[model samples]
Target: MRTRFTWGLTVNIMPPDYELRLKIVKNKIAGHEVSKLIAPEVLEYIANNCENDVRHLEGAINRLYAVTAMYSPKEINLEFAKDALKDYIGSSVYITNNIQKIQKAVAEYYDLTVESLKSKKRTAIINHARQVAIYLCKMTTEETLDKIGLEFNRDHATVIHACDKIGESLKKDEELREEINKIKDKIMN
Candidate 1:
């Protein structure tokens, strides 16, 4: 008989919840005596906004300290927090709405791979799918034409042409309009 051993251990690491996050923030503040330099509300703002990960929260705290140190402020307030963390908070939204998301949604809708849409193929189906992806990228993201083009290994003019072509096609083709709507609904929801 052969010896058999089975090990069962599962670890689920989730972001700390609201109260725990607040405690973590307070602990850091107390540890560094940051309360003397910044208001509790400002620290709370950082804790709530930087809720994605502990590392992000810690980074936000460090950034706040660095900025406050540079200015040598008597007190850091909500306005100061907003000014210091503008980029960090703003970028969280961009993380979700991006080209890869549009590409995946479009590829799944057309029953094609993302690679197929990105390829240089001139076949009607592949071209149409690529155009639709480009159109959706334009609709849903704030990324520039150059950025969208880079995603598909094309130039900005190619991206612009694809969007314009798809816009015109949607005006005349009811079936194509419905298909694009369904894909858009998937992405938006």
Candidate 2:
């Protein structure tokens, strides 16, 4: 059997602008029968963060509603909006660093095994890679100085010294600084 079909015109729904985004959120909340008054600042915050996608804007509203459903009629303010969409907020740290993640990325970049990178061998190559890894761990992670030191099998003072060395190297060694920044971008991105 053969069937002939004609395609209909497509409509592209571009993301709403700031004021329109605020209206959309307000309308969605009202549609849900949520009577709580959302502060203008809260709407503006969501609008700014979720502007590129209408789905993101709606998801933000859903997140807020889901988190605060039990406290119906409670006004959604700036802090509440921030807390609801913490992951999407620019100020929030989205990439949580782990020692293993750092070690793997650095080792891969240096073409060394993670075991070799973490070992006691002090070859110039491995040592340099290890120091870079340690510095990245300090910069990207919230791990304690001692904790990072433990992962690298070094003392906290050693980790501190490596961080200082890398920091100073970054100040004067332009090529090395760029290389390190590239590594950091790889880690975070």
Candidate 3:
């Protein structure tokens, strides 16, 4: 927190609300010819259920960009929206299930709180707990990287990085292996 940059101020932006999120998606669609391709209902669906992340909206739109280019669908209706955005929206995975269980196990094993695991804190102890949680979430659950990211307020790329970091360390570190196994055992039971 000392002298990384001349200005190291961090400003957190809250995720947009329902109407603003909808407007953001609609505006994004209109920026291209996507408004023509997508039905209003489909736009509404993306806005309503893309959760509270602006990046999720961008990701959903980017995915739409890909899907429309690949399939060249006639119209992006509700069905098309659901199909195209299946990886983006909906209560597909729940907090009471795989992710929460893994976070609880890892936090307990590390003597940290589940909130700390999901928090922006990057202390060595907290960061290690989060990385382990992400690794276990990847190995144990059938959830997508994006979905796992939602639980920790991280993006999919960060999730992938955490997994890779833990994986490489696991191959070379016996103490870390035992640490991970102990956490995994906590999760399984």
Q: Please tell me which predicted candidate would have the highest TM-score against the true structure.
A: 2
Per residue, candidate 3 scores C-alpha lDDT tens digits across 75-126 of 8875676677666554433212488888898888999999998889999999
For model 1, what is the alpha-carbon lDDT of residue 68? 78
lDDT of 2 at 120: 94
Provide backbone clash counts, one per model. Answer: 0, 0, 0
Instruction: TM-score each candidate.
Output: 0.49, 0.51, 0.49
Please give the lDDT score at residue 27 for candidate 3: 80
Worst 10 residues of 1 by lDDT: 1-10
Every model: Cα RMSD to truth: 14.3, 12.4, 16.5
lDDT of each: 0.74, 0.70, 0.74
Query: What value of lDDT does candidate 2 attain over all alpha carbons?
Result: 0.70
TM-score of 1: 0.49
Greater-lDDT candidate between 2 and 3: 3
Q: Put down candidate 1 lDDT per residue, 94-113, tens digits, no spaces.
A: 22468998899889998999
Q: Please rank every candidate by TM-score, starting with the best.
A: 2, 3, 1
Model 2: per-residue Cα lDDT over 15-131, one tens digit each: 664456667866777756553567655664565456567788888788877777766646776566666667655442322668998898889888899998879999998988999
